[model samples]
Target: MRIQEPYTSERVVLRHQGRDRTFVVVTPLELPEQPPALLYFHGSLQNGNVARNFTGRIFDDMVARTGAVLVYPDGVDRHFNDTRLRLLEKTRELDIDDVGFTRAIVDWLADNRGVDTSRIHACGYSNGGQMVMRLLHDAPGLLAGAATFAATMPAADNRVEGLGTVSVPTPFLAMHGTADRIVKYDGGVAGLDAAHSRGVLVSALESARYFATANGLGDPDHETVHGPEGVTVDSWSREGLPTVELWSIDGMGHVVPTPKQLPASIGPGTDSVVASDVLARFFGWA
Candidate 1:
């Protein structure tokens, strides 16, 4: 069956930490029995609604194919309280409890949406990707798996509190573009300019290695394969299923890898791999 529009979409509001937190939930027209949930966080300067359109609504297709629930969470002031110690000042000063907010959403899903909480997964892009990293470190057991696009782990010295403390192994995937200037693929200080610069980050490979090591996978078997549209796939895995995987696309930029055109300021994208499709397969939704 193909995905159809007019899926059950709702805006939910919940009170947390003396503030109103909101998210958008998109479910299939015909709900599956205890469907898995996917929480997607948006990048800086964008809200949940923009995130939905930014990715070309590929996730809606995932919802149709897998019978999974899709969630788009709004950040406080269009920014998540991610682990970047130097970049976001407003959320830092307010000390927004994004982690708690996420947990609250997960609980709500289980209670009202008939979701399988244990099967819940998370993914994000750019700043949102950093938020997902926060989840991996602060609440390792909260998610079954996680994926990040156009993001890498903050350097140890640049990380916020509670980072590097948790070593629980969870399946992790990271996709980065070699040509990205905002979040340098090889790692280092990131930003479009001094004003927007976030902070230092480890290389994308190092980011993958950090998780792989935490998973107790000593060394990853590496393989490089040619992908469509001048994209190359470099993966590190143990056994058939990759506990930690990294896809490094050549000439792609900070945007999610999709055929859909994005603003030129963010740089080029690829037609080779649609990020939502890759994410769906990674989470076993497809």
Candidate 2:
């Protein structure tokens, strides 16, 4: 598939909760009358621009192929106010309404860009992934589908009040590396230090099961597929459609899975599968 450059890109500012919030919108050259939309959330200490480059602009290819508008919303203080109970002092004190911010973005896209609000999907990495979980829990019907990378659902004791109580039946996809030290793949306390530590979490597979159960899918049918590099796929289906799926990349770490080069400090990644391509396929945009 040939990759196309975004036709136009701009930062959009909005007022919510008596504060100004901003997000980046990238439009495809050939846009549909009512295009499906994608909202991507960046990891901790990163902004929309950083995520755009770090992900190798692969999402732009999805935009090119599917005529979908891509959005990247900036988090408050470069960090999202996720569902974790133990949060940074500043983040806890501010208590930013991120879910409200997301709703505002969705509304803005529908009103200004002619986006299909019912088909909007979300994808996030690391800290951003936790935020996605918050969306899935707090704002159940907002997203059609959700994908998370290098993050898991927080353990019951470490979660905020009312989280994990209401579950949306939206299709869910999760990708995690077994070797991730920051958010341990095997589960337990996350982060290497107090500043970075978000909270405790369930195992990666358990995280997948959590969504599957919430989606009312039966036991998963597991399979090991051979790609560029090895990846283990576990899927839960209902009526022949996979409602929940997990990709466990062996020997990988905190970074997103892509053939493109990434900073080594984040830890090992795989060239076996492009993260965006998998997400596009899973979200039925491919």
Candidate 3:
């Protein structure tokens, strides 16, 4: 079965935190017995609408292959109140209960839609990825795994309060380009457009190690590959299953890591691997 292009959301009106919250969901035309769900979040300035097609139709294969329900959530004011405490504008201005919102979305899906609670997973880009990290932090039991691109944990100075101590040992997949200027792979000050700096972001490799430590893993086996040249993968696992993994795409930028053609506005991409495929394999749904 194939997911139709230009997917429309079956709206779920979740009354939480004293407001009517909304999210877009696209389930398979034929829902299997307790299928997994892939809930996606958008970046700093994007909404659910844009995330559905941000990577140039990658979700098409993801949803179809996994046979999982696909969801996109709109962040408050088009931004997820992630770890960064001092972000300018509405992202930091509003008191958003994004963690609660994520939990509520998962509960609604399990109770009403019969989605398998065990296999549920999420992936996001930039700010969206940070939201997923928050999910991994707070609601690990709800999500089996997650993948993040172009974002990572904030530096110690930039972090406000991120689950202090996490509850679940979340399996994570992190991908970032070595050339990402927006959220520098080396960490530290970056910006939203030219107006404001997002403060210090933790380096991508460090972020992976952080998660590895959280998951109780030892030093990761690191290797440099040139599938597309300059990209390296640092992997942590037990037996065969990947507990945590990081993909560093060399010479790439702050964009969805894909080989497909995207507009220049979205930034450069690589053909070394398809993100959806990687996530599917990571989540054990492929």
Candidate 4:
């Protein structure tokens, strides 16, 4: 039987330090007796309306395939940084306490929806991917696994409070595009316009490997081959403290392939690999 996209909605706000932040929550119209939940973080971009609209589309498409409950959390207007975009200097501002905000969202979901806390997973794209890494290090016990697509480290100094290198690493899947013009896998120009223009690149794979290794995952096993849509797919996986993997979609761009479901701004020629599928696999979903 062909699966259907579930009943989903937006504007479910959770509280953290008296702040009410928005999230796009979606679930299969009819879920299993006990199923995993996925909490998603959107990439670095404008906050408010832009985030809501963009994430809504992505979540709708992803849930269609995996049927997992999905949440798209919003970030502050600029980033973890201030107006200047200076990583180190911006640390002091820290307008959006993302870690606390995320936990609040998760807690709210478990209590209100009766979600299995242990089966909860996290996934994000680009800047959102960077947030996942921070959460992995800060709240190691919170997630079953985490997946990040085409994201790189925000800044070394953006560490979560009270987390050390010895923290248990979370299972992860990191994906990038090789032909990416922005945020080149090789650490090229880091800009929203550029990174979003193309897909993951070589430097991106290596950077992802660094995180896997740091988390106690062994060296990543690389996979590069031709995939659907006449595009090359490069990927890697690792094992150890926090098992992890990375995918570098060669010749692809930044947008998640959603067939006809995606907005025109995201473009076509992308694959239908489904981000939720990768997350489900990483979390060991049945």
Candidate 5:
């Protein structure tokens, strides 16, 4: 499919596994910019189209403030788990080529957007968070920093076969809602939850701590942002690699809320904490 580049959005189709996968690039129409660029993966219920179409005003504000470009990619129904009672499985296999895709994206951005490739970062929401964790763990040298909102680490049973070890350790940030019901803040109710309960836990933030410790980042920076609406933003990170930040919304249901947009039913603002801003802060791009 010949994807049209939206107003400011550019299109690049990657041929992976003999299938043409589409990734949308949005940012300044220049290349080799010394500013930071982000490679983002969207959560469940958010397809590439939705991710490409939905432009958060807060995100725009962040870009205006930090000059960071946002690149949103698509994830399949892709199941990363082979345990009993699996959630959703990818239509195809896990897009292992995503690493190559991301590498291409970063290279393309560097060549076309003038972005500082060394400072490139990765982030995702929900399942995107899971994807980011897998990418960082499997291909550590690819990102300088990576963060997630409402995501978890991959299960050992779901490990990609023949994936090599990570040489350059990347700092990471894992964000989640303590009260999340969808991807459960503690993994999941039946799926990841069982894994975590059985010590297969992959809470995004939890993984960061473990990885940081193994990577020799002891006692890293930890902070919490508490608001009146019972929403608490928890962030954790270490120097170098990629920083991981987790925003655990207390008493909030699934899905990060845009205070100024959408309704409260699907879960609205938990207070003044904006998911987009939190994401930006974690990335250090803001």
Candidate 6:
């Protein structure tokens, strides 16, 4: 199938909580049976299409090449109610069930949009990434695999007691740049300038370890890939269980990685490795 460049964008509306929720659907001209569905959450202060723009053709190409349906759900007021006690200025004041909002997308696509239930996947970047963690905790069964960028597991202090573990084995991939000041690659307090958020965060490594353990993987084997200068990919896996990989890039920042050479000013963006590409590969959609 010849996938078109620059995916088709469509706005979808669903009524939730006495309000109308909107999202953008980016897909190829053709819709395949049981095609993979990627429901992506936008970062704080970004709408669905805005989020789509940030990821660029990484998503457009994914839909074309893999025949996947990409859904970019808009957050309440451009920010998600993630797992944070102190959210950004625009986010800390609102109460929203993003999980329900996201689940509605899954159901909508499956029932109305021809999405394959067995091949559903979820991923997020920035604040959206944190939301993905919540889904893994709240609704792992809704996805075949999950990926996150610039977000980590909320620190133990951030999550309320009674958090549960997952019995399902959904593959997960987390990629972050070491120099991301907004979200902090080291996993500290997030939601500074945008959200005015305050809270300690678990490191990326800790988040990956937590998922590996929950997936029933024991004793992870670690390896650091030698890649282009300023990029380091650290991966962990075990005898069995879905794969979990964490990519750490040096001098990278809060931008969705693209497969194009970027200037140092943009946190060393590069086409050498795109997060969306890795995400599709993790789900075997590429």
| Candidate with maximal TM-score | 1
The worst-scoring run of ten residues by lDDT in candidate 2 lies at: 220-229
lDDT tens string, model 2, 1-286?
A: 9764556789999999898899999998889998999999999889898898888888877787888899999998888888788767455578888999999999999999999999889999998998899999999888999999999998889997666554568889999988898898999989867677778999998999888888777664444355445788877876854478889888888988866788777788887788888998898888
Candidate 1 ranges beyond 4 A from true positions? 1-6, 239-242
Cα deviation in Å at residue 249, candidate 6? Answer: 0.8
Lowest lDDT 10-residue stretch of candidate 3: 220-229
Runs in model 2 deviating more than 4 A are 1-4, 220-228, 240-242
Q: Alpha carbon lDDT of residue 188, candidate 2? A: 91
**Could you give candidate 1's per-residue lDDT for residues 1-286 as a string of tens digits?**
9754847788999999999999999988778889999999999899998998899888876786788899999999899999787765577789999999999999999998899999989999999999999998888788899999999988888898765454567888888899999999999999888887788999988888887777766553666677666666666567644377788888889998777799999999887788888888788877
Candidate 3 residue lDDT tens string, 68-92: 8888888878888777765675756
Candidate 5 per-residue lDDT over residues 174-250, each given as its tens digit:
55556665555665342334443322345545655665654555554667677446655454455553443455667
What TM-score do all the candidates reach, one by one? 0.94, 0.94, 0.90, 0.75, 0.75, 0.89
Which candidate do you rate higher for lDDT, 3 or 6? Answer: 3
The local distance difference test score of model 3 is 0.78
lDDT of 6 by residue, 9-112 (tens): 78999998678999988877777877888878888778888776677757767777778998888888888877766564444465677888887888898887
lDDT of each: 0.86, 0.85, 0.78, 0.59, 0.58, 0.76
Q: Order the numbered candidates by lDDT, best leading.
A: 1, 2, 3, 6, 4, 5
What's the lDDT for residue 131 in model 3? 81
Tens-digit per-residue lDDT, 182-279, candidate 4 = 45556644554742332222366566666666676543465566645544454445543665566656565665433334444433325646555555
